[model samples]
Target: MRMPYRVVGGTLVAALLAQLAGCGTLFWPERRGQIEGRVDPVIAVLDAIGLLFYIIPGVIAFGVDIATGAIYLPGGTHAQVDPATLRPAVQPDGTVNRARLQAILQQQLGRHLPLDDPRLIEHRGSPEQLAAYGLVPAA
Candidate 1:
């Protein structure tokens, strides 16, 4: 009993493509659930797949879970803060007070974000605030 050449070729091609796609990231571990504090979703799903010996559904579930927004999006131009009313004056070095900036962000965003981290507050200068600071928007 031998498989057809076409069947074998198709299987080989599919396996090669799957390997090239780097499916490992799909199974990457998420943090332990706060409730259980021990069950790792990724590992649990993977272990279930091992028991079932069916990879497709496991891979699909893993991809869906990982692609979900567990990560925060970087705040860009839309996140810029108004300097005047916010009351955080930029210093000579073009930096604002960390605490003041955090306060303003909390007020505007209605949540406490880590503004002390430059990454969160980078590119956060508002044009209206700049105008009040005697600066004009670059055309």
Candidate 2:
């Protein structure tokens, strides 16, 4: 016998599949042009499956990230911006200057980051662009 969780999961999966099928109709024109000939039901099913698997997770993750108020940039340091000053200070060589570290932190993390939160500002990393200058993380 199937567990209760399994039954709910199966129901959710079926609902998702139905929604995907309805959505496929909207893309028929684009698919027709790409396929260049006969409309293959098998190919359409495969494409819809792939689309559902890829899009749903990506959208959920993006929504969660936004809700948490955090921005993750690839290879870039995350830092809080100073709402009052709106700048992260840098040294003459563009390294993270401890004296003007607040400004440096803002610049590295981008103006969009929440600088009002002291917790986030304190945890920011050094900018990759300035890493070669032998600069250390500010305490």
- The models' CA-based lDDT, in order, is 0.48, 0.43
Runs in model 1 with CA error above 4 Å? Answer: 1-83, 86-89, 116-139
Model 2 agreement with the true structure over 66-123: per-residue lDDT tens digits: 3332222122333444433422454444444454654555455654334444334243
How does residue 61 of candidate 2 score in lDDT? 36
In model 1, how large is the Cα lDDT of residue 139?
A: 43
In model 2, what is the error at residue 119, expressed in angstroms? 8.2
Residue-wise lDDT of candidate 1 within 1-139, one digit each (tens)?
A: 3669889888767654544343333343332111112334544444345334346655564444334422212233346565565544445445567777667777787766665433231355677966667665554
| Candidate 2 residue pairs in clash (backbone atoms < 3 Å) | 81-115, 87-103, 88-103, 88-104, 89-103, 89-104
* Separate clash counts for every candidate: 0, 6
